[model samples]
Target: MASSNVTSFSHSTFVLIGIPGLEAAHVWIAFPLCSIYIITLLGNATILFIIKTEPSLHAPMYIFLSILAVIDLLLSTSTMPKMLTLLWFDSTVISFNACLVQMFLIHSLSAIESTILLAMAFDRFVAICHPLRHASILTNPLTAKITLMAVIRGALFFVPLPLLIKRLPFCRKNILTHSYCVHQDVMKLACGDTTPNIVYGLMAILMVMGVDSLLIFLSYVLILRAVLKLASRERLKAFNTCVSHLCAVLIFYIPLIGLSVIHRFGNRLAPTAHIIMGNVYLFVPPVLNPIVYGAKTKQIRRRIVRIRTEQKGKITGIYKNKQMIKW
Candidate 1:
């Protein structure tokens, strides 16, 4: 029976443990998770809508932001709904193929987001470091090419992940740690050799995130060097432009680092800690990114306020017209 199980990858299924040792609290825990998902969807959608409709926002920075918004939408959507199902409906079963698909989406989207953030850093670097050539350097065609490259790079790098996992034989240890599938968690359950999966996954992460992070840091260092040459007032103004992106960088990387640390080094920690960190790593950025940009970005902030003001005026006009008709 065990040998048969080892041979049958097609018939294998995995069960997701939503939050280990907290099964009884799953329903109660779902309320906040659902709220976060809804907020992520709405917030990112609003960012995209504003950037799309507002002509003044048709620049390189906003363009990158819109791409980030789309990524956030896809990233959260990839994992949250299934997580909610596990929490609310107690539906824990996921097929091997489905699990692979989920893992691919989650990891690929993360790669893309990291690339986008790095691109945004470069955009800022060019803007601050070479203000005169900003427009020439980041033309529409170039921006489009950059966006396309980020997508293609992310997708192509992880294409091997699912294929590698597919080749692994499972020996019936098919339980997962999180609500959604991840390459690391799923790879652990396979009874076959996981050294290839481990080595490949690490290489992919280093190539995508590790390299991007180093470049982003280098870009900022150059940007700071350029900014320091300006007068104090000009330096302040230039630094202000990067505030939102800096906040975004912090929010994104902090949780991710925390989760990675917990996964690798904190095995003695409670499973709940691991689960909560994972959720925060996935959910917090989407929920907070829009809010950060909306508040710190002057153009987006003014547009949002103008929209609300116009909406209020229209509502008042309709109410007055109805009152007049009643009279």
Candidate 2:
């Protein structure tokens, strides 16, 4: 009986509502999201291919880039598929278990991505501040260890969340206002007082994201100081290298912080605001990462062009050889 009641409540709350502005806004959101998704996949895949095929890009920076590409892929995958499904099918009825799983994956990936960015910052700091020690400090073993720790830490940090959600007794209202299963959005449906969930959520955000951001900021501060003391050319070069990454960080973090604030407080803005920001946070980095790196890093651009040219030449030569054989 209890299970039946919970199911009924969940079903009633999970009904889909088409956007307020209707077809125009729907088309606006869908078109850009689809375009961004395609570009992001192509860009990230190209970066991954370059890193794998070109030995020159096997350094710490590109290794981090490869990792970032993978994270971006996962991050986009976590939300976009369901979102696109909702847009296409106009169905938003996610089961409670499904919602919990989505929430877990989203938060876990978010934490992992933030931690990886901090690791990247530390990599930059080492490269700039102690150039001689760059190779030794960011060795393959160390990089693998850091990557492992990021995954493990992110998983462990968010493991309790789904567990807590499962244990909660659902109230009469189980409908999540937003399209997806955000932690706070789901917590709002609990029958009992949600003080514990709120506390845990805030603490997790503070400890995981807050601390990681602080460390990254400090690392960059030291890097800035180190850059100032260097030759003007080197200083400029360092700044250029960091600019793309800085832009990416801002685009990612700003919306996330905004989401946190809106969720914690009340949602004064339109519901579409939440949906738009969610899409932005998920899709922007994947789309921009390739463009940034390809534009900023001349070496990568050269290698990509070279790779394509070589492929074309090989195809031409094969055709010519076939013609000569036939003749």
lDDT of 1: 0.89
Those runs of model 2 whose alpha carbons end farther than 4 Å from true positions after fitting are 1-8, 11-18, 23-28, 311-327
lDDT of each: 0.89, 0.78
Ten-residue region with minimum lDDT total, candidate 1: 1-10
Candidate 1 Cα errors over 4 Å, as ranges: 1-10
Q: Lowest-scoring 10 consecutive residues by lDDT in candidate 2?
A: 11-20
- For the record, the alpha-carbon RMSD of candidate 2 to the native fold, in angstroms, is 3.8
What digit string (tens of lDDT, one per residue) describes model 2 on residues 54-136? 98888877888788889888877777777676676666567777777888988888898888888888888898888899998
Per-prediction CA RMSD (Å) = 3.0, 3.8
> What is the lDDT for 32 in model 2?
70
